[model samples]
Target: MRLKSRLLPLAVSLPLAGTLAVALPLAAMLHAAAQPPPAGAAPEENAEEPGLAYSVSLPETGDSALDDAISRASALEQLRERAPVDAFGLVSRALAEANNMRDALRSEGYYNGSSRVTVDGAPADTPGLADRLAARGASDQPVPVVITVEKGPQYTLAPVLLRTDPPGFPLGAMGETGLAEGQPARAQPILDAQGRINQALRDAGHPFAELGRRVIADHDTRKLEVTFLVTPGPRALFARPGVTGEERTRSELLARMVQPLEGQVFSQERIEKTRQDLLSLGVFGTVRARAGDRLDEEGRLPMTFTVVERPLHAVGFGAAYETRYGPTVSAYWEHRNLFGGAERLRLEAEVNRLGTTGDTSDTGGKIGASLRTPWFLGRNQTLTFDIAALRERPDAYDRDAFTLGALLERTWSPRLSYGFGPQIEFSRVTQDGVTTDYQLLGLLGQLRWADVDNPLNPSRGTRASLLVNPIYSMGESNVFTRLRAQGSTYFDMLGDKGSILAVRGVVGSIVGASYGGVPPDKRFYSGGGGSVRGYTYQSIGPRTAINEPAGGLSLVEGSIELRQRVSGPWGLAAFVDAGSVTEDPTPDFDNVKVGAGLGLRYLTGIGPIRADIAVPLNKERGDSAFGVYIGIGQAF
Candidate 1:
């Protein structure tokens, strides 16, 4: 068997005849075997016990990988430690394990490897071996068993050959099929090469490509030769896609999304892109695309888009706590496919600063409604409308406002987008004990780019956005242009989200207006859990005569975090944040404030639940010594 150059049989039959000889009761069987026996007692050939225990030890095979594989694949090791077996049963298991170990070696390119099994220092086939162990008299000691292997020289590959059934079918480069001469002929790599060939053919418009392989080993040269047989059906173009399983979503909306792919050359990349586009509509839980088995008369392939829609309506609530700013709560209700065109509508409300100050004027809450219409006027564009009414009392100001806005957003590519719209607002603001009413109209413009792998918890890539707003005050007759830009990037220090470095930066300014001329709600302030962290909400900017935040015309903020995953569903993060806000049109670094913090994270299906504690590095007389924040998702 050692020199067979092929895998050995792994199955072994139990010889019940050996156990039948010792079927008598233990007390009588032991006495008969030990002594010369009673005058009329029948002589038993082999003695055994009902309870037999043994431990298996595998010696080094000079190759650590092969030795580990043998231990994992051994049935004897798993059963002996778990199930109770008699002496004869144990011997039968050991005989089966010998062949398993040999197969393990052959999988690692050692076709000529050999394995030997023994019990109590006797070969497994030794006559009366089980009787020797059981005759020791029902002792509790575990019998010792040993398995050893000798792995010979590993096999290498001869030149790999690829053949197409139709002969000369376009397969591109066959030389780079991940197989080469003299490379180790391991089983996994050989199988992976076949998958690569099939995928390549499908990517080149051969949707029904099939692959077959033949592996032959020459023990004389210690080499394996492999040939991949390919059957590439017919080249195909994509036909109009058919959709199914849509309960509320309109079929015309889906057709509009896939119109660009119809009559085009079939491509795996395009299919994946179309699938992802459907999922982004927020109505589908899963989307799958399949190709027809037969090509049409025009040499075109029929495609189908199968979808599973998510629940049409959902409601959720969230809560967060901060040490000095007190607690905040929020809730939202959403309809995913309103009007049957995959339109989304949501209503939300939030309350903040609970249990902080005894005065009711210190608390704030707001309610708003938003709607999104997909495929609005164009395939790559969407229309969004929002209306909100809110009253908020932060350290910077106390104000009440009602706002309405609409936007037309266009997606240029998977990673880039831009939008522009008009908005109107009516507000009554109180700043530093001065109250004023104003009606404002503005033009809103925005640009965004994102290439991150995950939105809630990202370990790689960058996200960035820019906003420009030009507002005109009806009563004050003052015009101001607001500009803000923010960007964040993530580095995967250790692959697979085990360790990451995340960085964020922001800059903003209000041009053509003084700090006092702009409305308080529009002015930028830089403290709170989402900002500097160690101070109260809106607490880190320019101050008035009474030592309260006066809001600022310019702002700058930056943060850096090191995130490390500790174990399953748990992680840790350490971060530093810095920010500055000034009455000037540009940032003043001299007024920068810094905070340092550590956080704990529990990962869930939606995102990571995070809790952070931070201390002010440059503390002031009124600043809190430390701030604690709890919420969902990474603190970007």
Candidate 2:
């Protein structure tokens, strides 16, 4: 994290001469002490001496303001480690420490403050102290150290002046330059003022503006005067952007990603946005965007974008475990720049329900491949094609399925996007020992909006999505539509460091079809880690005569969570989820099943590793006592 310094005005009126008299004795004591050895090393002979024990204290002054400043400036408070082998070492260290304390006072505008150090109840200058300590090395007693300080009257600014090359520049527009007359005269404020002025000029189109002079201090009159001489270079406009370091990704594609327009007023913000856009593409390992130091003949600033390409091919594996479903394992291979133009291709395989109390026929698996291309006919759009084969044996049905689909997605802004797609599928499904074959074709549309601060672990903002699918059975005379909508919102109850409240809701329905007419795999079920939890997967809806789940035509689910950071990289969460699946076209709220749970989060650079344990509030005979889930990222 970056540290920022601020200029705070000091309010005090005291005589500097009086405070100096009190500090003069302490300064004399420090001056008489011998120079200490370099830090982290001890003299060979003195190494035998035990480490010295010491304490630092500041006696209260009648003035509360000076006392507070002294406390803040004390060296003892800032030292990470403190140990001295002998009296000589202690006095030497104390002498160096006194100088640091004095500098701290000056930073607070106390140019005439005084400080002193004492060891073993006596001033450091006491004669024969080193010899006495050498004789008492065998003793177990610890040495005591003390520091005294007297901060004199703070200084005030006098007749501050800031001049730039351009005439009639508005210096007042720069807030808190820290150089106004009668304000505290401190080093930090003056330095901060210079930086603020330089930045202001750069933001106003003077990219080359810089400080040209120094500050002058007048101690005799207890006043300071500072001058900010600056060079405000000529304003410039942006020229066409240039790109380099391209191997697979096309140069034209990169050029189009730069948002700044030619001949527009040059801006630092615009340049930064262009850099971010390139990074979002994910094909570049590193990206740099900078404006030329020299202007072109047309008086336009030429900008260049240099990037390093990342490796195009990669393979990885993933796994997830649940108490109810056992474990699922997956692997994938990807080519990020397939055929250039920033296209992507990926192939994946996954197996589920390992180590469960069931035969191989009860297990499930999927194999799939997908391809995506950027700038599909327009800017900020993508076209994707996917094909997959799957086998599953859930309580409601057993099935072998094949699907092919294509989607066109468009991003309107950073926070909003929409997609439409067409899909076809063929399936062989079995229910209650009876088998049936079906073929279906569908068109799907979706809209989504998210303004969350962090995609992995959001502490603020809202996210919402809507999906609609209209389907026609090719083998049978049947038609139906499925619509689902989900929304979630997050709030930081105490800002970044405080707890977060996250709430989510989902609702869906299948229209124009009865339970027997729709595919079992496409029907809604409200159980498992991503649904009502606590209950077994697909176990919360209508049930057959044999107690197996019968999938429903409608769904309703909601969840609420309170997440708190317990310590560094560790967090705790408590949540409640409730939902129901109904055979009716509309949800039946009376049969809702509720689950409550607790979760743990370990924060990582990419996201959080999460584990959750849940128990059903309305447990049925077939429901397990508890369910455990482990995965990466939040459940939502």
The root-mean-square deviation over C-alpha atoms between each candidate and the true structure, in angstroms, is 10.2, 6.7
Lowest summed-lDDT stretch of 10 residues in model 1? 20-29
lDDT top scorer: 1
Residue-level lDDT tens digits of model 1 in 19-107: 21111111211221122312222222123436577888977877776666676666666555455567776676677666566556656
What is candidate 2's lDDT per residue for 394-461, written digit by digit as tens? Answer: 77889999999999999888899999999999999887677888899999999999999999989999
What would the TM-scores of all predictions be? 0.85, 0.79
Candidate 1 achieves a global lDDT of: 0.80
- Total clashes for model 2: 0
Query: lDDT at 480 for candidate 1?
Result: 98
Residue 332 of candidate 2: its Cα lDDT?
99
